[model samples]
Target: MDWREQQPYARKQGESFDVKYTGSCYCGAVKFKASSDPVDAKFCHCTGCQSLHGAPMQWAAIFHKKDILFDEDALDNINFYDSENKQNVRHLPCKISCKQCRSPIADEGRNMMLMFPVAFKIDRRNIPHAFKPTCHIFYGQRVADIKDGMPKFEGHKDHSNKIEE
Candidate 1:
């Protein structure tokens, strides 16, 4: 069946994830691109994720910051803020958004970025299999239960899972 077909905000026209992909903020005030590096995807249900995305869950894919290309002007229109980590300490800038629209563009760190799939211009039908979300993280904090077959991790993916029998 279709992945995430139940999603509310449908992708914008002309969004496609191919060998290489480009993405932008909701208002197109900022844009960037990444090579087809087979980034892994994750569905996060932590409270931080929920509040940050203003949703119950956040769908994200990992990419090396070096692979992403953006226009200098577009970069100028972006803002940065550090999110408190599990330790409750502010780290490097984590939240990056378009200043014009205040729409989040990505979660950037030293070398990696966790991108929102909706920000990319990819047709649901054309999304690469590798880009498909494989697990639910921080399942313990879910605001609403998701009954998908994917493993539900009680914490991080490498840790234990919460399986209901």
Candidate 2:
């Protein structure tokens, strides 16, 4: 099946999508904008996510790599972390963050990027429903128990079994 069919937006060449969200690194040295709503959003409880985010879980939103754009200066101030020494630098997916403030920007995959919701310019008092996480992934690796009613997956979203509360 075509992946775009499962996504929220599919842009054609020459077509444009307006930026719907903007975010910056802690020191404002790096910035990014997302042109469309996320394809998926979830709370990640994987050990890698916990270690990198220094938190129990990470609230992440997924978007097609092309739909998000970083500032021109972002390249100069960003750092990339690759767990594997995959020689294909051009298409290698890795975590990227601001070098100045050490703030995580996003986790870039082959065709998608997982952006942290906390890094966006959101109004704490009135957060949009779109940014809310729909499920908890990697629940088997979680360090804490959450009683929230959201579905908890033992691994990848639809690829794993949903653990009962």
Scored by CA lDDT, what does every candidate get? 0.72, 0.81
lDDT string, candidate 1, 1-165, tens digits: 231121111223564433388778989988777766536898999998898889999998888665565654575676767766533222554677788988877776666778888888888887777679988999989988898889888888878767551
Q: Count clashes in each candidate, considering only residues at least 3 apart in sequence or on different chains.
A: 3, 0
Tens digits of per-residue lDDT for model 2, 44-87: 99998999889999999998887787765666786777757733
lDDT of 1: 0.72
RMSD after CA superposition, every candidate:
10.1, 5.3
State residue 22's C-alpha deviation in candidate 2, in Å. 0.6
C-alpha lDDT of residue 66 in model 1:
52
Q: Candidate 1, 8: how far from true, in Å?
A: 29
Name the lDDT value of residue 68 in candidate 2: 82
Candidate 1: the clashing residue pairs are 15-121, 15-122, 16-121
lDDT of 1 at 20: 83
Cα miss at 110, model 2 (Å)? 1.0
